[model samples]
Target: MRAILVLLIIVVLVAIAAIALGFVNVSQTRTASLPTISVKGGSAPAFNVQTANVSVGVENHVVQTPTVDVKKP
Candidate 1:
C-alpha cells in the first residue's frame, strides 16, 4: 500500500511538472489591420470579445451502453 501511494505521488508530481513546462509557448504579439465597420447613422455599436484564445482538443473515448432485447412469447 505504501509503495502504491509513493508511485501515485510521483506520477502526480511528474504530471504537474509536465503541465507547467508545456504551457511555455513563445507566441509573440503582432498587430494586423482588420476590417472596421461603421454604422450609417452614427450610433455606438458594441462588441463582446475582449481577449479570446481558441483551442480545439480531440480525444477518443469509448462508452458502453446496455441494451435490452425483448422477445415476443
Candidate 2:
C-alpha cells in the first residue's frame, strides 16, 4: 500500500513537471462567456414591526466568602 501511494505521488509529480515543461499541451477549443442578465427595477415591500419595550436593571448581594492562606517552606 505504501509503495503504491509513493508511486502515485511520483506519477503526479512527473505529470505536473511535464505539463510545466510544455511536454503536455492542453487547450480549450471553444470560447466561453457568461450569459447577460437584465434585472427590472422594482420597489421592495415595506415592513411594519411593533416591538415590546424592555427594562434592564442590576441587583447587588453581599455574601461571605472563605479566604485561603498558602505557606511555602
Candidate 3:
C-alpha cells in the first residue's frame, strides 16, 4: 500500500539522518570525546564539550586538545 511505502520512506529517512549525524561508531577510540550532559528544569538537557590531550608517534611527539567553554545553561 501507499501508506506502508510512505512509512518505510520516513523510517529510512530517519535512519539516514541519524547515520549522517555521526550517531554510531564501531570503535570507541575513533570517537574524539564524549559530551557532558546537564539537566535543567527537571527535563531540559544540554551538553558541555569534552576534550582530551593526545600524544602520537615516537621520539618526536605532539600534544593537542580542544579548548571548550565551561559555561552551563
Candidate 4:
C-alpha cells in the first residue's frame, strides 16, 4: 500500500513536471537552445569526519523445548 502511494505521488509529480516543462503540450512557440557555460577551476571543501564502525555477526545456539502432553477427549 505504501509503495502504491509513493508510486502515485511520483507519477503525479512527473506529470506536473512534464506539464510545467511544456513537454505535454503539443504547441511550441520557439525552439529551445542550450546555454553556453564557462567553467573555472575550483577546489572542493574537505571535511575530517569521524564515524563509528559497527560489526555484525550471527552466532549459532542450541535450545531445549519442553514437550507438550495432549489428552484426547
Evaluated at residue 12, the lDDT of candidate 3 is 95
Error of 1 at 49 (Å): 56
What is the C-alpha lDDT profile of model 1 across 1-73, one tens digit per residue?
A: 9999999999999888877899534565997888998768666788898887999999999999999999999
Of candidate 1, the 10-residue stretch with the lowest lDDT total is 19-28
Whole-model lDDT per candidate: 0.85, 0.99, 0.84, 0.96
Candidate 2 local lDDT, 5-57, one digit each (tens) = 99999999999999999999999999999999999999999999999999999
Best by lDDT: 2
**C-alpha displacement of 2 in model 1, angstroms?**
0.2
lDDT of 4 by residue, 30-67 (tens): 99999999999999999999999999999999999999
When 2 and 3 are scored with TM-score, the better candidate is 2
Q: Taking the candidates one at a time, how many backbone clashes does each contain?
A: 0, 0, 0, 0
lDDT, ranked from best to worst: 2, 4, 1, 3
- On the 0 to 100 scale, the lDDT of residue 43 in model 3 is 59
Q: What C-alpha root-mean-square deviation, in Å, does candidate 3 show against the real structure? A: 27.9
Give the Cα-based TM-score of candidate 2 against the true structure.
0.47
C-alpha lDDT of candidate 1 relative to the true structure: 0.85
lDDT, candidate 4, equals 0.96
| lDDT of candidate 3 over 9-33, digit per residue (tens) | 9999988888888885445556476
